[model samples]
Target: MNQERSTLPSIWSAAPPGGIDRSAFTGKKPNKIIPVPHEYRRQTLSRERDMLIHDVEQKTGCDLVPHWDQGKVTSFDIYGSGHGVEKATVYLNHWISNAHTKSIGASAWAKLPAYDPNKWYYAQVEELDNVYKQRFRGPVPSEGDADAPRHAAVVDWPEDIKNTSQEFVSPREVFGNKLERLDELRMQDKVYITLQQSNHDGHWYLEILGHDVVDVELAREHLTTMIQTVRADAAGVQDAHNTILDEREGMEVELQQCEPWWPNQADYVVPQLLSHAMMDKPGSFRQEGLHFKQHLSLQRSIKAALDDVRRRKGAYDFVVRLGCLALSSKTVSKGIIGRTVSKDSFSKQIHESVQLDVKKWLANNEIGCRILHRLMAVKGFLEPTKSGGYFGYTPETLKETRPIFRGTWVFKDPNSSVVATQTSYRHPGRPAPFQKPVEDAQAAPMSLFVIQIDWTDDEQGMYEKGTPTFYKLPPGATGPKKNMDISLLELGESRAWHFALESLIPVPRKTVSPVLVGFAERVRMKRNYDISSTESFAEWDTTLNIKKYLQTGRLDSIYSFGIEKTCYKVELTAMWYPSQQLPVWGLAVRHLEWASHLAELEDLPIGRQAMWLDTISSFLPDDGQSSSNIDEDSDDCGTRRLKVDDSDDESPRDGIRILTDKLMKLSEIVSSVTDCGGVQI
Candidate 1:
């Protein structure tokens, strides 16, 4: 009842923001009984999928199978003014002809006479090797002998192979008839609550959008029957229409007749008129009469569809709400009521309703649906197509989009005792120079910046919340704010370790190993500063959950925290190069490897290989230990056990420190590699 008042005739012209307004044309008494034209225009064309298929088989020597229902295809009509009928018929006919030609070969297509631009034609073919076979229109090589088997006779097209011309031709066309008939039946049984329009012609047409649910299981039957009635009733006609203005008086008189004692009388009558008008208009829908009629229609349909499971305390309602908000103009954020619903509730509804159903809406609107699917993936809501580039948010990652921000690190060259250094990490790859190093390499005094966003997608997926900007400040400084006195390390040239920390080389320089003592001096000059950042903790949590869910499809798996504990384990990773200096190369490599390898694994598949490697690598001899291996029980106690290699006077005690230094270097390499998201490529 409240819904009826909201959609009263007076509000028919109301339009939402960013949409066309037509409310001005509503509510006032009609000057005459003439029907009001539907807002959208409709053009009709001869509809016959089966006839087309038949023609195709006769002309082309091959067979084709239709994936759509023939009856539904025939539901389309050829109607319009100013060549609308001719234009529509020709258009559909040519498409059919083209399908036939393409299915056969260029040779067969060329043999068919040029199609008349103003007439309709039909063709059909059978499925051969699961591909629709049609006539070829291009040249075919002639056989040397007159009796040689004809080249144009028949050919096979494999289902798995790629064929550009036939890519748009789906096997589903065979079901078009059945679906169309179902739609017709649905429309007939439905008591429409709003305006519906035929194609672009302003004529009345009927289609079953949905049905009322007096009973759940029976509703589907009722809906299907309504759809069939609408289609069958209009099958033979090319010119037809329904207008809202035509029924206004009858509704008003009916309301007046039941006046004084009736409760919610307007509700019953208004819905009846709206339904009548909807039936009158075939290919049209109410965009103005009701602010969100289509949304309401689908919502109601969903309610009915889930009737069997509706009684269960499921996440359906939450998903519906979240999807509606996401697709709306609402801004999403923490504390925002609709922003952070659990992924289970948020992702499911969008995946099923918005992603799947809305696709059909576009098709009915004469728009394609493929691009929309891609857009969903871009926003991180739905699983991306196989060819898409974005990773992180897949099921393997707890089905969460990882949020990352741009960040930079500065540190002095360990070889340069005089200066501290800083570094930056970026997307295309890690900050260069550090990724590749030689023996005499010097730490590049540069900044590293990385940007990342979470994988959760909003409704319609228009915005992506990537990483935020991060800054590191010097000690005594509150943050990366103005007036903070800080000295930045001066990078002489760039240098980084190659492979693991096996070697170091200077950026842009071929040889000459830089001194470690100088690099150590650079480190001394630097001091820790304040670090400020906005991390995507939600996304992190989501990714962790997604990883678990991927391992186990159960929704309950999301709350499990197995991965979080292991994420921060203190373990050694193999360095890309042998350089004892902590270079980003080793870290970057390790991260890339992890992303590539783990991205494919579910939480359960996360093997122990990495764990084992970390353990074994931690046991390698420290640098100073190798120099004093002859002694086992002496370390100057533990004080001289430092790992730095000194002169002969240095005792085996120093070996501990040496070993510690080597181990630290190794650990740093492993940590760095795994820390990076993955190689951009």
Candidate 2:
């Protein structure tokens, strides 16, 4: 594959000055020179150099130029000169000392600006040795010199002391009493120093700054203390909360054991129980005033206990009823399977469901059963239900119906081919060949099946109850009118309960082959599946749709078969025709061969894949063109082969070979995936 190369812009911000050449910097023999006036050039060059030196001094805070006065020298002999040569030479020595100090200071700032005075300075052996030689023995020899010292050091010096020497001296020694002004810059980690040059008149000094290191130890200590205090407080609060919860639980247990007493019951039962106890006391005790007082105190205590029980029981009952109602409403809302129901009817159903659930719960609960038993003794008490048990469909219903759908109703036969084609006969008068009979012809392989149900406008009012009122078959006069009518069938109470339960419970989904999953994924990704205006593409999943139809036996619409080709495409759809039914769902099966090949092409670049598709399509017949030609003289029992015209330009064998290679490659891919824990697409 040939790929196009992209040219990128150069990284340099700007090109070098146009007129300058490499030879100018190297000081080599020039190929060409442009002449200019000597005085003009001299003044311009001098000013530029002066500006450069001034800029460097300002930025570095160091004086590079020497300040000295020199008289005319009459002779080349330096020692015999009598024109204040000694004073000028003294100034020259001061300048050299200042230069050395500046050089060391600049190097220190560049390499270790934030050096900690507490930690002794350390450097490479050769580097320290070179610095030592430069400071004591003068400048070292140039690199070009054969006798240059590469790693020279004092033989008498200790190796440890040489590597860990103090690079910067105390400013107090250099500044004397004047160091007090620079004290603010001095810190435990760093200190300021001055580069100075001394003459007979005064001293020239350049103040060098130091790096500051902020101390965060105190702040860190405060934060740690604060965090510990917060955690301790949280633990204390949690402990108190747990103690309260334990006490509350003990109180609730005591309340559950007591019979709930309502205000109406207190009006009659409380007085009666107290009166009975007082009358049952001994005649002698009843005559004494002290015994009477004791009886009254006992009566008051019993009344307070009953009141407490009533309050707790009332609140508990309210919360339980509210929670059960909410739960039942949510269940009813989500139970919608095929159609929607009306608000009034849906609410009624929710209330009924809640009533049933609450009744069942009360009958089974220990406290609730006790309350009901006590209520049964009351004169006007009427039971909520005669049976006092759940009357709706339960798990037993599901168990009994399990055998009805059992046996070999649906089977998986991997060897069975889904596609079927009719054989053409050459003779018009010849009868079809005899076919072998099978014991069970009704049996069909476990393939995808879709069924669509339609409801009319007259049944629209029935949706308010969450189910259609009536169903009508398509226009056909096959059976008697009475037999064809669904309303004619007498549905028993158990059958109605079974139907309701089945509608509420979702159908069990079946798992599909990975190959089908991969194909569905590709179709979804390509958005190649057909859809109606009422349907949303987002809700469409090929795998999920097929599973739903296989499980629920309900389909919304019938899909177009799409353009026909030589490759097999299988589909089975059943739809009902009604005037006002909702839109039907359908499935569109593309050419199996093309679908499998396209899955493999996913690894290829989009552009290349499209090109390959176009190339292969060119070899295949168009939709308008016949896929295969049949010979009329061919025998019905004999194999029916596609008869290709020799006069055609391209041979059919080439196309077949290409398709076969793709299928073989697909098989290899599937085998490899299966060997290593196959992933579902």
Candidate 3:
């Protein structure tokens, strides 16, 4: 049949015997089967096997290709015994591949009768050539690379390569079983290590070879969670610190604009008085002077806020330090491994970077804490003393009059009225004139005095006259002494009395004329007596006494008694009386004296002016009338009084009060920033 077909057409020949041009007559060109290079094929197959091994290791958490004593055994012969004959043939079975099956089928098809299963070897290979084309044939994974080593097992198989049981074995199941065996070996402490003795006689060198895969993964997860938590806490602290900074800046600007009066040596006394008043009746003082009390309350609140901020800052610092310690521990653990381990350098770099970040965070917290402390200190300096009614009058003091003095006098007869007098000259070895007979008397009798006492604050008896009385003198005294004791006590009450003494002085007598005995002798005697006389005539003017008493009281020499005459002594005491009327003229004169002392400033500063007006207003009868309508004119006392008109809301007093209130509100806002719920870590 072949001879007959060749003779007819020779269709299979490259060219037909006849010149028919069969190449052109063919319908399509036959595809060429290009031969793959051996090196390329090997590399491509190696990558495919590595990818498969990596997939199984990820699922099983085990090393499919384990390290051996001779070197990294990349083949299935884990013992590296070239014969490959072992009772435990499980690993050899797992190394079987399609290449072994193809080679066995080719030999079986060849009909070789003496084919040995032990001679058949396993080689890692893929059935589809497309798998080699799809994979990237890059450099093979190295021992230290994070990727799985690109290795494939080549083993001398002891079993038939065509066994269907080998095909049913899953790579993941085999690796999982191997991992369990590794765990068993680890638990039994069968994993061995190499120890080298150094050249020094007493020295021994040790090296850490590897770590448990499970333990390392667990540690990594734990550290990752801690890192995420630290990052969150850091973000929260940053936000809070920034908010505090902004509030503090705003408060600082407001504080700069406010020029509240600062306390001086003279002004410090008012704070002491106010503190005492507050201590005496804290609740009442706070209730009555709510506006004024805001200054102290805000100060305390700010201090407490500052303390809270400090505590939170400390906690934040501790957390930062703890994070730093954790990072350092991680770095130290990494350093325990060989320097050739790339993660050591990476971990050390991360630790250093975190340390710098921690330092910056702590520095920012410190600066914010310092600013809060400064704000607290500034708040401490704003005391409500100088401009708040001379220590800020309470409701009780505002309504009632404060008595300057009180006295009780015993009389021999109820109808008799006696006047105490001081003699001009006193006899030697006798009691001095004007001296009280009763040593235990409440107050000494005044020789010449003028007093202005509160009469009645009610509208019907607002101008009631003050009664002028005198203490009875001893029988032996005689002189031009004026008994002056003024009382605003109710009528028909004589034993006990309340009064405010305005002035007191001893009266002096005029010089007596010398009589002439003979014409020449009388002239000589008159001239000699006039030359020797040291006493001078002095008039008793209550106005001058009141002025001298207001300015310097007993401190002035003009109101002082001479050494030969005894002076009247008075003991004054302060008492609260709901019915007692305020001495308006006396207060006015005292205010005038206070103003005169500040004459160098020309006019009181706005702060002092407010204080002065507030003090004067407190004494008023709460009728809303200004000082001008108070009727403080005292023609008898002859002292200048303050007559301030109610300048309405334009007054400095009201303006200062408003400004102070605004400042206190601002302080409250500034302190609110420190109210963090608690420390965050």
Residues 473-537, model 1: lDDT tens digits: 23233212211011100000001111111101112111101111112122211122111111111
**Best candidate according to TM-score:** 1
Answer with 1 or 2, whichever has the higher lDDT: 2
Question: For every candidate structure, what is the RMSD over all alpha carbons to the true structure, in angstroms?
Answer: 36.4, 44.7, 52.9
Tens digit per residue, CA lDDT, model 2, 299-356: 2322222222221101011000100001223233333323433323433542344211
Each prediction's number of clashing residue pairs: 161, 6, 0
How well does model 3 score by local distance difference test? 0.22
Candidate 2 segments whose C-alpha is farther than 4 A from its true place: 1-566, 570-589, 610-681
TM-score for each of the candidates: 0.13, 0.12, 0.12
Prediction 1 TM-score vs. true: 0.13
Error of 2 at 346 (Å): 51
What C-alpha lDDT values do all the predictions have? 0.22, 0.23, 0.22
**lDDT score at residue 674, model 1, on the 0-100 scale:** 23
* Rank ordering of all candidates by TM-score, starting from the highest: 1, 2, 3
Angstrom error at residue 45, model 1 = 38
